[model samples]
Target: MLTKEAFNALLKTLEEPPENIKFFFATTEPQKVLPTIISRCQRFELKRISNELIIEKLSAISKDLEREIEKDALYQISNFSEGSLRDAQSLLDQIFCYSDGKITLEYVNNALGFIDPDFFFELDNQISKANTSFAFEFVNKVHSLGKDLSYIIEELIEHFKNLLIIKFNSKTSKFLSETILKKYVLSSALYQEEELFYILETLTQATILHKNYFKKIHLETVMLKIIKSKNVLSLDILVKKVN
Candidate 1:
């Protein structure tokens, strides 16, 4: 944002700068900067930090600080940060203050008022199976438990992504074991890539539309959409035509 006064004051110095003085300007939003200033300065772009790298650094920092944060907790912070190392570290700092050293995924969830990941997994499983009855029942439970619908939608997107990974990978995990991974691998077969993409898009769009309040009617509609998604393809079962 270039105010007229600021720009005018800088214009003289930039146009006839002293040899000893170097002016460096930095902004997260380069588009807001004046085009004239942009043309005059040497520009550098900083890319987003990767989650794994951030997690790796957080793990080291936690150990050095004797925090002993769990792996899932770090993963949760990494996922929450979305590639901002500063945000991730800030979240870790919050968790550290809240936990006083011993950090676990459940602790993080409770601290953040977030529901368990397993709830989202159950919801995803029922949806992938097209079990509308169970799906709606689960929603009722969620309502009774008073979980945040917005957060559920956010976590559900991540749940679907994990299932998508199981489709192509054959690795076991310290948390999600070989047996569970194999199960998600089977569940992943129930959905097409396009179907998952559509579900993610729809859920995200629906989530964005909700106000500061929870509406069962809106969630119910999303459940129906999940159950009867138009993008679904029968990949798990084969049907032969009668001759």
Candidate 2:
């Protein structure tokens, strides 16, 4: 960012640039980078690398190095990397060292302290059955495993959001493998649309409020609230507690 006067001077030069002059500006948020500056430039927005591409690249790397890796493991690595090739490579590097020439889901979860989708599936099952005691036991097991409580909350929020998406747009599951898609479809049946939305809202707020000490307790309390609320939750009440 620049002062108005400085930007004006730069604008003047850009409006009538010297021959062969070139300027490059990059940002994650281009909309905030002054509209006047944008009007003078040709824009090219870079799209994120698709999960399919990332997974393919990871698979190639693992095979070329003679390391056995599962397809689901590749997808998980791709998902966590968030479309960053450098990050994906770094994750693969760590995974390679941790794996004994063969990478499995359990190996990845244990090595990285990653909360597996199985955890969410089990939790969802218990919640569907209105088994609050099981949810508590699950949370205790997660805590004992030294998993990141905050991360789990965020992941759970994403999981339910996916369920809501699948609930409304059933065709969206076609993007996922049949196995993963089946899980989401089954999970979606356990909640009404508004119930999932209420949950997503509460968990989001919990992320901000419970970022301090005793996060494990905070996460457990919120999970219990969510699982126990078989009916639609009072949004007002959930917000009040989170706030």
- The segments of candidate 2 whose C-alpha lies over 4 angstroms from its true place after superposition are 1-43, 233-243
Q: lDDT tens digits, residues 72-171, model 1?
A: 7887777678788989888888878766657888898777677776676676667666777876786687777778665667666767777766656646
Per-residue lDDT tens digits for candidate 2, residues 1-243, read 566688788888998989997988777777666779889899998887888888888888987998898777777777778888778889999989865767886776676677778788888788778787875787788788887777877778878888998999878653355577788888889887777877888788888634579876787788887887675557765686699
Could you tally the backbone clashes for each prediction? 0, 0
What is the lDDT, from 0 to 100, of the residue 107 in candidate 1? 90
**Model 2, C-alpha of 154: deviation from truth (Å):** 0.2
> Residue 25's C-alpha lDDT in candidate 1?
85
RMSD of each: 4.4, 6.0
lDDT of each: 0.72, 0.79
- Most lDDT-accurate candidate: 2
Each candidate structure's TM-score, on Cα atoms with residue i matched to residue i, is 0.75, 0.75
Model 1: lowest-lDDT 10 consecutive positions: 234-243
Flag clash pairs in model 2: none
